[model samples]
Target: MHPLRSATAAPSRRALACALSLALFPFVAAATDGMSDARTLDRVVVIGTPTQPLTFVTDTKLPRQPVPASDGADYLKTIPGFTALRNGGTNGDPVLRGMFGSRLNLLSNDGSMPGACPARMDNPLSYVAPETYDTLVVVKGPQTVLWGPGASAGTVRFQRETPRFDAPGLRVQGSLLGGSFVRNDQLLDATAGNATGYARLTANRSESGDYRDGHGDRVPTAWKKWNTDLALGWTPDADTLVEVSAGIGDGQARYAGRGMDGAQFKRESLGLRFEKAFHGALRKVQASLYRNDADHVMDNYTLRDPNPMGPMPMPMASNVDRTTDGGRIAAEWGWGDVVLTTGIDAQRSRHRTRNAMGRDAYKTVAWSPDATLRNTGVFAEGTWTLDAGRRWVAGLRSDRARATDQRATRSAMGMGGMAMPNPTLGLTRSETLPAGFVRFEHDIAGSGFGWYAGVGHTARMPDYWELISPNMGPMGTVNAFAGVRPEKTTQLDIGGQYRGKRMDAWVSAYAGRIDDFILFRYPTGGMMGATSMASNVDARIHGAEAGVDLRLAADWSVGGSLAWAWGANTTAGTPLPQMTPLEGRLTAGWDNGHWSAGALLRVVARQDRVAVGQGNVVGRDLGPSAGFATLALNAGYRLSERLQLAAGMDNLFDRAYAEHLNLAGSADFGYPAMPVRINEPGRNLWLKLNFTL
Candidate 1:
């Protein structure tokens, strides 16, 4: 039988999934004696390619090429159709098929943790430590209504598996890493549990000094961060579970792409979740409530000496914070050949800011509230098994989205230190958005082929970054808040997957049309330098990601994947700004039960189709970026039943290149102020050790 399976086929029972995943973990077989299977090598090293259609899943603890330095964006970039807008060595912003920001729904443990940076220096992924989570799931396109709304681009979830035990026992896992540029990291996960209850703790710390680029130039990108989380669960019976979790984290990072660096990034979180199963047609019920907060401080003096000849010639700091509270309740029901899930979810976020001219002076000032955002939605998804191998899935959703502008005054966005009275002060805007999708999937009888086609639509409300960040609106409008309209996206997606004894392949492609699509224009520099204006325009987007894995021999395999995206502003007759260039990756692997090795070659094509003076809130395009290729190699060894070691050398050729989606190197770093892209890292080496008990 073939192994082709869709992500929607995930286990319906939590206990069964946990037990199966723990027992069948492939690494266990490869680390123990009496194991001689040639294919066992698949479980020994990095997983760069995927076999599932429309979804990608991987174990977070596994070693990977380029060895991410505790950053979730770095890890996600390894997947097809995904790339990071590089800032320095870490905390890059993730983009999927040219879509970023609120278009991609990012969640950690079923909760939302939005960042507070007005310029998005500290994106959502900046605070997520990949190794602390158990599984990473990416669902491309707005094809599912189970998660919250506004996911026109896709949905990404970092999950911590539910822990279950038949008897009282203690389990522990840990890893340590040391790499070039004084990079170091430590992580630990421990659990003590019995049949009726359990306690789990996860903690991690990561740090790195400034790194040199391919030109041997030192980039201001040093950072240090840490996180700690504790979870307690009660399972009165095999079919019931109640869990409570809390976490806190903080960090700081210097920047090479912007005038100011991230002086502080503090995070706080709390959550409660409940799950239960029944014997009747009502199969399962799950509920959760969570609150997350992000507090950030940006300053020019903390990381580097402020430029005496440029803007902000003195030490200046800005402190911003956002608090997000959300909850969800879902239930699953099964009747013969049909299964359905219904849920209601809501979220509220409040933002505040304070600033001062001297170091640590902002702490003495009272915070000023500027915005409040809220969303509430209800959804229903159902799947019908028409036959043994054919299925139909459909979903419907409606949301009430509200945004309040609490600004007391408006600053002349292009005039240095200029202030003006607010025009939309304390005004509230509300809209009811509807979203839905449908799909038909079939598994070829007695074959390795499976295919699915789906169509989806989502009407997205203007987020804080889009609604409030820009200083101006379209030509005649008063401001961004009153001019920018909601974005409506309709997209069609199709994919197929095939799994055989020696080959695995998958292909996914999508096309979308966006109405009233929000676009930002960077006009000529004014008194305060270049400023952006928010406007609405029609747009077209399309992309495709395909992969194939071939096992030449029992112990040898080769794989390759390619991703390409394209977009155009139909209203302006220009290419879309910030579109990702074509990218491809090739990998070759060889391993025995006791040892494993692999090589990765990444190639990025030049992006020549760019709307030079337009983009999103992150930044605008800087002409065309040239293409480049880099190679990375990794090796691993099973030291014993409870221990293992892995190492990697990235950018082996030390070729200098910058991504298309990049911020210009800041003048504070001794670069010309002509908006040149920041170069990536040079040759790097790292080693890691993992242990389990």
Candidate 2:
């Protein structure tokens, strides 16, 4: 009963195809390059190197190794210090520095979009289609407070650039990709307008069938996804701006590790923002508001046959949804060599669900409200330029957070398959969390080298999945919500970077102590199978990620990155569960005029440490894992100023392997009931055509 695995599609597929064709006709016919400057074809990115200390910025439109992912979590695997628990082809939850769940603040256009699945089948990153955005920004560790709270791990933002036109015109950029497993994708981003105002639209569709592992065994990893976004903006002056935006999307993903497949994933969003700049001390003011809705449905019958002997023998479906709303306002002030930024932000989210025992039966059940979460925070940051090559930066923030439980009964964790009265029903929990950080950066005079060090502390309230997903609480407690406490983390961060004529290099390291760290334990043999229990413990974690890129010639380059993390539970004197093993990537790329090619080699060391039944809500450690190595090759050719072609071969040797942070394959999918990690895709091939007009 690995939770059931597969997906289903609805009507209007012909309509979807027709709309895409019509929208793409004009762009394809106009094939004139509109770039401001001449460009050469860039090789596929094997691993994205950080651009600054503790921060990474990359163009999301670029091609990547291991073929492009249909979801955000898969795309993020291209960055160091990042990995995802493998579920299937899409919607895998991302983990940074061995941290999962809300420890990482995920945002799109500065607004949070949390999913409704208690087991996180639809994590925040699941809704993000990386290519739809213009830029991807990552701030590692709790080094800044500009975003919202509970970013003890870090913050991730996917942002789209504002469209501008000095004169009336039309611009478009799009791509077509095809790969193994019947994989196909189409993307279109277009804009039209003049200086007074502009209209922009971004859309994409992707689908794939089940893929085979290295051993030629099929893994239930099929999926279909699509999205459409529109934005209208007004840029009246050089320093003034206003915008309105809206988006809608839906998707279905099959997971080999879960008992239920995602039959439906629907989303809707709206937002508004304003920005203004002044000439003097009052530098700028910015404000924005956004609302997002996440609706999801998971069922066993849609994609697979329920095994009569399995834990879930009957057809069943569950529908869940969450609505989130938030707003933020900030102002920048400049005085001499010093600058300051201050802002206040607030957010509210509500979760509801329904379920039934037959096909699409959940549609007839009344929705039940389960939880409400709210948070308000204010922050201030200041930067002082002591000299041309030296500077100091600091920030402080405080958030008032609250959570209310609305359930009347709770499922017993194998206690005779009975429902128990909710002891914490209608109870409200509140906490005031404080966070701050300060760091010093020096450029070493005229040298192209810089270094920084910072200390940060933040208190985080237990998130929904941690408090609500777990079936049990600490001993002697009624449930997770009534017993679990907020976690407090104090960490030290250090990093340095060098940018020379022929080479660029960077390295970052961190160590942290967590008070009342949240931990989930999976106990087997329950009436409903595996059950999750939540508790708190004292823990310590440390990790480092480093990389260097060197140019062998004007058109040839070589680079590599390494990341490793280690943690320990002080309370139990055991190694941390679900920790990522030591991993490294090596790449060689060449770009000559109109043609480009590259090769990437990735390696992972075996992970022997274990606390087998303990991990986050999605899964627990499944014993020790053998390490593996994989390779990929890519080539690209610029056909003209307006179009380019790129192709790749991943897992060149067809090596079979599984990640340490992955969920156990479901018994319904033929996996042994003793928890076997799902294997990754085998050798695969793909081709992509990119165009701009």
Please give the distance, in angstroms, between residue 629's alpha carbon in candidate 2 and its true position after superposition. 0.2
**Residue-pair clashes per candidate, as listed?**
0, 7
| Pairs that clash in candidate 1 | none
Cα lDDT of model 2 by residue, 216-317, tens digit: 898898888899999999999778889999999998878788888898889999999999999899899999999999999988887777767777788888
TM-score of 1: 0.93
Q: Which stretches of candidate 1 lie over 4 Å from their true place?
A: 1-51, 414-416, 524-529
lDDT of 1 by residue, 538-601 (tens): 9999999998999999779999999999999999899988899999989998877678888999
RMSD of each: 8.5, 3.7
C-alpha lDDT values of all predictions: 0.84, 0.86
Best by TM-score: 2
Candidate 1 local lDDT, residue 527: 18
